[model samples]
Target: MRVLMVSWEYPPVIVGGLGRHVHHLAIDLAGMGHEVTVITRRPSGTDSLTHPTTDERSDGVRVIAVAEDPHEFRFGTDMMSWTLAMGHSFVRAGLRVLAGDQETAWVPDVVHAHDWLVAHPAITLAEFFDVPLVATIHATEAGRHSGWVSGSTNRQVHSVEWWLANEADALITCSESMRDEVNRLFGPEEIQVIHNGIDVDTWPFAPRPQTAGPAELLFAGRLEYEKGVQDLLAALPRVRRTHPGTTLTIAGTGTQLDWLMETARKHKVTRSVRFVGALDHNALVAAMQRCAAIVLPSRYEPFGIVALEAAATGIPLVVSTAGGLGEAVDDGMSGFTFQPADVAGIATAIRKTLDDPAAAAVRARRARDRLTEDFSWREVAERTEGVYLAAKRRVRHAYGRPTIIERPLPERDPGK
Candidate 1:
């Protein structure tokens, strides 16, 4: 089957989990004898589609990057702008390919859009091309840091997300918690839960080299105000006083970087805090392996992909009982939990893992076992393919028949 994958970010231009998810999904889909064509917004200096740069053409998959108009709003950063831009680009790219005899001319049987970033294009392609559309809502605006949408800008973002969820043929999310939230937001059974997964082999399996010390705690991801990084910083002061040599390693760069740095300095624990801004995949895995435990102090989280990553890497985690993250981190088993904004609770959870190495090790192994059994990219992709098949059937039933083709063909090209 031919599939069109739409996303705002991909490798070399990723901001978070969405890009990584799309990249892995496309690769897996292509490997499964499905022709996958990915359309994403181009980073600056990336030669745009008039000269369309092909990032890769592995197996039967192709990637097309289109330059998008970067009109920035106060709150709209990488995701919002790129999503809007990707929408426009997807329509444009679809038209360009449909009009020609390009390598991607076979046309796609299904349009799979990742997150709200590609929702615009996902909707447009579904209507304009009359194909099955499947959207994955990684998280909701309400679930991100529990912030209120007051202004026009905030409303616009929320509006886009709502539109995508409603317009798509089927909805996918990363956890049962998110599925429940989406169901409540859009009515029951509106969203399907497909937990996030990681490449187990890529992550560091063993802990980082350590000395007799207090312990090291990790918090990785975007440095946004809603991410509750400040809470982690506040917790650090307390944890440090109790465990003398405790150190906090924050990996990842975001809008709240300066404030977090200032918070560390103000708490007089600057020496114990290391702001290792933005690690690549390998670096992050290594850091996770070394830390005593990983903490996600988000105000609200949809699925907590990082928690899964930590679990897969045999790293115990401490996640806030925020939104969907609670579903991912099995409190007292895979990891521990605390109230969303409780600084002392966050500190105490980290201390638990540090003080009880034997128990922590047990949880870490269980976490790894759980990931291996349920959350591998291969499993995720296979489940996602089932979603695609269901979506195709729904579209077929709605339309009464396939319009452009008789059946889903094996591939556009018949012979080698």
Candidate 2:
């Protein structure tokens, strides 16, 4: 099958977990005897405008890059950056198609778009070609529980998300929890739940010597209010009271970093909490192995990939029962889930793990086994391919013939 995979970003240009997920899925699909052409925005750099770049045969996958507007790639607190990037991506993809390059002549049998950021272009292209479109909603606005956003931003994101689900042949989400959410919010749409997977080999398995008497708790990923980072900080004071030497390691940088740090100081827990800032994969995995257990205090998570990463490393996870985190963690088996925003609950869980290091080790082993058997990339790839095949079948039946789709053209050409 020929597949056109659309994502806003890719490796060497990751904005979030979604980029890494897309990169792996494409590679695995190609390995399974499917031809995959990834369409993504070129990273901002000197090579941003050198026409189409091809990543030929890496892990048996072929990737095609179509450069997008560099200005829209700015990263910050503005949520609109993603929406604007999607708009430009559509224009750039359209231009590439019109250029009539033989290198990209094989139009996709099915279009798989990841997240709301690239849904606009994916929907337009699928409609233009009358092909089946499948959208993977990594997260949702309602899940974030954010207060009202700008009218334009809200409407734009909501419209694209809704249209993608309504127009696409089927919808894909990372967990059964997300499947239920999409169904409840978007009416009865065909939704498939594909849990996120990790490369076990990539994440080293040997357990590092646990942090001494003062247990170190690690939290990695974006630092945002919705992520419950502030709530975790609030829990630290109590955690320290029980385990006097407990040290919390907070990694990653975000809009809420200053406030989070200030809150730690206000509670005089700054000495107990170490703000490690953002870390590369090597450092992150090392931290994960060394920590007693990984804590994810997300208000709502679609699928706690970080939990899977920790579990893959033979480390127990304490995650919020909010959203899909519950599904990823098996309470008392591999890890435990607590109610969202309960600082006391988080602290208590930490203390329990610290109380019996041996018991905690048993749980960590269980978590690692679960990840190895169920969530490896090979298994994930096979399941994802099932969705791609289903989408391909849907497109074939709907169009009755092969249909070639391209992104929408811009109203005005800036290059001119």
- List where candidate 1 sits over 4 angstroms from the true fold: 44-52, 69-83, 98-104, 145-147, 207-210, 392-416
Evaluated against the true structure, the overall lDDT of model 2 is 0.74
The Cα local distance difference test for each model comes to: 0.74, 0.74
Best by lDDT: 1
Quote each prediction's TM-score. Answer: 0.87, 0.87
lDDT of 2 by residue, 323-399 (tens): 77888778888877789888888887777777877788888888888888888777878887888777643433232
Where model 2 places Cα greater than 4 Å from the true spot, the runs are 44-57, 70-82, 94-104, 146-152, 208-212, 392-416
Show the lowest summed lDDT stretch of 10 residues, model 1.
407-416
Clashing pairs in 1: 208-290, 252-278
